[model samples]
Target: METSSVLIINLLVWFLLLANVLSFSTFEKLVLPPSVTGPESASFDRGGEGPYVTVADGRILKWKGPSVGFVDFAYTSPNRTKIACDGTNDLKFGPICGRPLALSFNYKTSDLYITDAFFGLLVVGFNGGLATQLSGGYKYLSGIDVESYTGNVYMTDASLTSDSTGRLLKYDPRTQRVTVLLSGLSGGGGPAVSSSRNYVLVPDYINKKIQRYWLQGPKKETTEVFLTDCGSPKTIKRAVNDGEFWVAVEKQVQQQPVLTEPQGLRVNGSAVVLQTVPLTQFSDMTLAVVQESNDALYVGSSYTDFVGVYKN
Candidate 1:
């Protein structure tokens, strides 16, 4: 996702969210430590312990209530030095210090999987430290999700430098091998495996579409356009309430800095848009993640020092 001017969110509006929402308000704000920014994506452990977020400095931070604030959880680069990498946005340091973009936990094993724009895919244990690299040559890896049932890792590669024709990849833990499941994708956002584990919804930033890539059933190993009207969809997250998905979208030109009508959408697997929240009113922030945890929505920006918690 792209960065925008840092803005505090104040969502003072009312609407029927999935016809179940009663009120819309900011529940709380999780402010990051000074200097560092970009809580690009978040995840919780199997024990329901976190809203752990990845920052721009190539490290992951965990929230432990208001008193403890955010503590150092993990980092991707073994060569990274805090003096050179912390709070910096220099692209030249990406390969040297690593820039972790997305993360998902294997709840079954308590291992966290991470995708760095320069470090490929890596995993760390429950006791956080330097993560171990799993696979390499996966540059610009955007989103990642692990199927806790089988330990199969699903991720996307936005092959921007090569052809801009992205791909969907899967990693089998048993064989320690990576497989290309689908190709010809825009592949900018993270993917969501369905609640039933039948298929995964993948977002295309180039095509402006969300396609269903089947995992099982008669339609297994096939792909279909699940959504198209979503504006440059970024990250798709599953709701804890009903397994429905919440997506973050932005109306901005390619490589543009200014954003317009950024929104968060609650959509079903059938591609139905259940509810839409215009994010411009909430914050001037251009979000990359709108995740649902319990009855609240966690909105994340790549350049903000705080993560906004919206409730209904």
Candidate 2:
């Protein structure tokens, strides 16, 4: 009887552990049409009426409803024609079709700023159509974020060569001036400013680290590694909580063939991880952006034909 009781207790303990491991919310796929692929990043408007996404085919699409699906919001290049650009992911046509990667909104002006993999940075007003080119002359513009209070844009240039020739830049909408904040970043991912607007967290994808750059306060203009050993973080977005952020990470597992596991982590301003959410259900896709709105998490991928929503 004593042995049987001990066996039952151990079985219960293992059951609880398994339950904890499966505690994550199940992700429901938000499927896009065949023409739309690679919704790399998602942003919502001031009115809370969108999960507007930038697709690989060079268009920013707005989600209207389940029936209407995503409608055309904006295009990066004015020369982009449907015949030449739609439903394609060829890098050679990137210069003409304009592969948009990251997106953020300026709430004050109701304008959206985007980083094109080929076109550098661009913006469009509330009534979207053709986005105006704000800055260019960069090899690859990977990520972007807008300061809601000042309308200034922070962005990252991933690389010039195969090495770590990346750079972090700031673009002033008022003056139209572009300033380089930092260079020598190893595959810079994305920038997410703090709630106080005093610091920005930038991810180094190649180095598997996140760096914090102070924009204000006593540590102004200083940069430091916020977190290390992060598995190829892609986009860092401000969390719903103050002084916290959500980072999307892609973990590569090498066996005979390589496998990828995606995850989302919540970290505080002091570089402490608060929570980690596994996104392995979308492992086949490159989860580039994980954004939080209300109590739900929105996941975007640059290689999948769907976005994912996981609600807690």
The worst-scoring run of ten residues by lDDT in candidate 2 lies at: 17-26
lDDT by residue (39-137, candidate 1, tens digit) is: 888788888776888888888989898899888899999999888988886769987778888889998899999999888999999999999999989
What CA RMSD would candidate 2 show?
A: 4.7
lDDT score, candidate 1, position 129: 90
Backbone clashes in model 2, listed as residue pairs: none
TM-score of 2: 0.89
In model 1, pairs of residues that clash are: none
Give the top-scoring candidate (lDDT): 2
The digit string of per-residue lDDT tens for model 2 on 269-289 reads 888877788987787776789
How high is the lDDT of residue 33 in model 2?
A: 65
